[model samples]
Target: MALLETLAVVFAVALVAAVAVYIKTKLFPLGDGEEIREDVAEYISMMVSVFYALVLGLCLVSVWDNRATADDRVQAEASALHQTYLLADALPAEQRGPVREAARSYAGHVVDVEWPLMAEREPLGDDGWTLLDRLRTAGELRGPGTTAQQIAAQEVLAQIGYVDDARRGREAAAEERLSVVLWAGLVIGGVLTVAFMFLFGLNRSSTHVILVMGLSGFIAFTVLLIHQLDTPFGDPLGVGPDPFTRYFRL
Candidate 1:
């Protein structure tokens, strides 16, 4: 839906600019084929195009890095939970069952409940945090009977800590997004870039129209790409629940 809206806006702008340019040429026309006007237009167009390209490149890099970080967080969280699940074997028999169960339950909640919410950019609610708390409590085994048990308990605590930290990071990443200011810049910059295309004088009407259409389409596509990447949990290009599924078999 968002992509469609962006495309519509870009197309509308391009069509309006093209029509306006065509009408201007028919009515007013160029003055005595002035070389100065063409020179000035060419210089301004070149400068604007360069600046716009830089802005687009920066936006792309920012969003790409964010998406990559989000993926890494998901992997880290899933791996930590998997480690905690395995460490349960070293825990006292009484503690092992509950700890392992809690770990499994947490992974299930993340894959089934939290993932959908993240994709929608919605809050995950207290349920996920509650599950994490349960996992933490289950691992709080005080003073084991033997040195080996004590060592195992410490390892369990460490793994659980890692899980807690990674879950927090994952939640943060899910909520991450481009700022409104950056969005404004993207839209305004795209408009200016397309509008500048009209300033340059072209002898062939067909060539001018084609250039406008191609430029508009490319801008719209780039904006759509940034939007999709802005929300790492968004569909198609989004990070999936594969890490959790692989570890928990959910």
Candidate 2:
């Protein structure tokens, strides 16, 4: 089974067990002297919390790297498109404006339409790329006249290739859903963190109140962090849309 499915099963079992134990303890009292060891519970909760923090730290680091990579790719793509647009001047005058216009239009599409879609983890279709191809074809690319013109054409072609590669990279990055294993770890870790709370029955009613509040807060915080990292675009903590906006004056 997939790791997620496995974790789901485990989590369900653990949750049921926890509820049963809680109910059973309330329904029937243990022997007068028999109860959980306080020191042992403290040690276990401390260890589990430390482990949870470590896992959370690692997850944050991974997500940060992914976010940085995506941002860098966007900047690189915008710069390449700008270079290609400027290079349009090398083309015959009749061809220059159209080529530059196409590049500009494509950039606008990226900023206005495609960028937002990407933020939402959506990919724009062939239409966007087709416009790029139109720009590429706009130039009357000739054979080896002066070595310079040939070199310029080669450079333009390279820029075109970069844009294509960058787009593919962006798409791949978007598709990079967090692995099922990591998700499994997250779920199991959460359950374990909470289970560790019940390792010892609460002595004072005040202690029970505090434990319940603390566990609820921790769970809420962890879940919010994960959600923000998961989207990497839509949430306040997500990667920004500066990539597209910076390119165009838009």
Candidate 3:
């Protein structure tokens, strides 16, 4: 639904701009004496488009890499937590329940609480780390009595270490954002690219409308794509709780 609405809006804007440009050409046809060289105009338009494409490609790559990093961190964190959960069964009977409960609580907190904060780009409190500390404490409360229990406890601690490292990465990724200068360039370059095409339009009226509208629509779509990718944690683009649900059944 969101995609449909966005496409409709972009197409509408492109249609309107094409109509306006077409009307302008009819109202003020270029005089023979005022006409610029067609080759020069085409060269200028091509350069503007190339420069704009460079900026667009940079922005797209920046956001896409950030999004991929965020997803990777999520996968690592969930995997480590799942390892922690599995190691609990090897723990002493009394310690097993607390450790499992701690793992479940940690998973729930991430999915139910921390995820929303990330989606909103909100500052995360230390509560998540605190839960991690609790999990560590829960697992380490009693010393392992047997050699097997010792190995299990040590492995569990190592997995928790992985979870902590991945959590840090996730936090960093959540704060990732595209630079303001790039965004300014994106907007200005798009406007200039479209404006140049409008200025040096085609001779055929129908062809002019088609060409201009197609360029306009494609540019609009690119801008929208950049914006969507910029918000790696937000809806319509973000990876959800699938990793957690897969392992912990959250």
Candidate 4:
């Protein structure tokens, strides 16, 4: 589901549950001296809250790190491609143009073709690999080239290798996500935390309702944030093709 829709559903459900509980409490008021031990329930609730907070923190940190790493990979790949394009200037005239052209084509393909696929969590076809191979072939140094040309060829190969590594890292990061068990824990934990709030009898129903609404909304927001970060290439929050665009002027 879309992020906004998911959030609306979560908050709506939470509101409905809170209201239903409030109504039940009103119809079946607790008799005098029948209240549970407030101190013990408070302590238990506090502990649960702390545990759930820690889980949420861990999830946030993990996804943020993944997103950062994905961005770094993109920058590194673009930089390597840029360097390869520049280094081609030192190649023998016969070899130089093809190398530069191949590098440019590869970068353009990444920005135009592969990026959209990544956002959709789709596999990149062999087109990119073909372009990279063309780049590598263009940089191949045959026997008896000028010393400067040889050095440029070697540097181009090195840069291409860097691009390969960074592309792999980018693809891996794109596929990375929080485990299903962790998601289950997050959902269940949030529900329990909100349910625990109902255990405490508030003096005013209005105050109780307000508190539940606020807490539920906050929890829903946090979950939505995590979901956005879960897919590093997802819309709006996902990393863009800015690196390639900046380096290639495309």
* Model number with the top TM-score: 4
For all candidates in order, the CA lDDT equals 0.85, 0.73, 0.87, 0.89
Q: Write the per-residue lDDT of candidate 1 for residues 72-177, one digit (tens) a residue.
A: 8888888988988988888788988999899999999988898889999999899988988898888877654677878877887787778778778888888888
Each candidate structure's TM-score, on Cα atoms with residue i matched to residue i, is 0.83, 0.75, 0.83, 0.84
Off by over 4 Å in 1: 1-36
Tell me the tens digit of each residue's lDDT in model 4 across 11-89. Answer: 7988998999799789987889787557977998999899899889989999999999999999999999999999988
Q: In model 1, state the lDDT of residue 152.
A: 74
lDDT of 2 at 175: 57
As for TM-score, the candidate ahead, 2 or 4, is: 4
Where is the poorest 10-residue window by lDDT in model 4? 1-10
> Clashing residue pairs, candidate 1?
none
Q: Model 2 reaches what TM-score against the true structure?
A: 0.75
What is residue 180's positional error in candidate 1, in angstroms? Answer: 1.5
What would the per-residue lDDT of candidate 3 be over residues 22-135, giving only the tens digit for each residue? 998899888978965589778978997898899999999999998999899999999999999999988899999889899999999999998999999999899899999999
